[model samples]
Target: MEKARAEAGWLMPKTSGYAACAKLRRRGDYKEGTMDFFDECEIKQSIQRIDELLGSGIFDRKHIGNVLYRSAFIDLLICLRDLMFKCRKFSEPIRFTDDVVVTDEIKHVSDLVKYVRDAVCHPDSDAHYLEPGNIRASLNVLYGKGTLIQTGDFNSVSEHDDDVCFFIGRQRIYLQRHIVRAFNEAKDKLLPLVEAASQKAIAESIAGIIR
Candidate 1:
């Protein structure tokens, strides 16, 4: 995660040329007033949905954590793709190749978010453990080493052997807390980017119509 931020800082430098061009194209058409207010409304609705989910106290921390991280990550990716498409930078794009992975920093974060989601959702799965070390390891794979540090301890067993039962009876409280914090932090980091991308895409689309 840290590595990704650093790389994004380095590679992205500013918004993509594609983004800039798209924004310019949209602004150019503002005189015609072709802006799709409906699309903007939809994006705002989606953002509101996420806000509600994050603010809701109904779900436990782990579940909410998974939802927040997954939703936020996906929202950003879709926003970027939408922006690209609206700007004509990406036309009828097909399957993304593995070699092209590093071109987009959001892709790396998406992968980490998936790994973390899987770890949290299926704690007993043979996949990567949800331990902090493992979480950091997964993030490092995509972003680079030292990008994320797993500061807390994730290994705590119950006194009674049977006490480590499913859902309710384990030491998941701590894990849930950690997951919530991570998701909240990730959401905070990603939301602004997503919003900007969405707005840019909408502006560009309107501009295209006006042109």
Candidate 2:
């Protein structure tokens, strides 16, 4: 500690930490107000975050639930695709050496999401207020590295993450999880191909603008 303080040139005064903390608080020194970009109505009204928009009851909860839950599944694929698209934009198209692509499981989930979207969006609908606690969930998609996933221990799980779906609920509820092991394996294989492609694209773009 002393070495670190000396290295940083933070020569402590003879005064103790308690005295320093009290002095800083008396002057009202640290709490910055929220920035303008954030929506503050929820904070002001003391509305729960999900309740503020998704839970506000402007629309039916079942419809909202179906739409948002489906969106989580849809967005995962979209994010990876968009990231790859952006990476390829300023460079050449990305290529997977093994021709690995979205797994059958992911394709099914994608189709299911589309079906759910149609059901909820239609005026004569098929949406249901899916009892979140009642349904037995299964995993077909995962968002991170594959692990054992049973113990729920931090390190072991990190080392061997199994695919598991999570339903986040409050006023609004949605199902979320990562893609399957196949997806994770493909991502590991393909990221190298696009990583450089993205950098190359970015550099060329900046250079073109300057020229």
By summed lDDT, which 10 consecutive residues of candidate 1 come out lowest? 162-171
lDDT score, candidate 1: 0.35
Would you list the C-alpha lDDT of every candidate in the order shown? 0.35, 0.33
What's model 2's TM-score? 0.23
Residue-level lDDT of model 2, residues 1-211, one tens digit each, is 4333222222224555345434544676324431110112212222233224333432332443455554544444343343333333333333332212134422333333333334434424323223344422222222234432332222112212332332211011112222233233334444454445334434544555566
lDDT of 1 at 28: 62
Q: Model 2 clash pairs? A: 90-201, 141-178, 141-179, 142-178, 142-179, 143-178, 146-161, 147-160, 147-161, 148-160
Give me the displacement of residue 182 in model 2, in angstroms: 12
What is the TM-score (0 to 1) of candidate 1?
Answer: 0.30
143-173: candidate 1 lDDT, tens digit per residue: 1112123335533222232111111111121
Give the Cα error of residue 141 in candidate 1, in Å.
29
Give the clash count for each candidate: 2, 10
Off by over 4 Å in 1: 1-56, 59-116, 119-124, 127-177
Q: Highest lDDT among the candidates is held by which one?
A: 1
| lDDT of model 2 at position 137 | 22
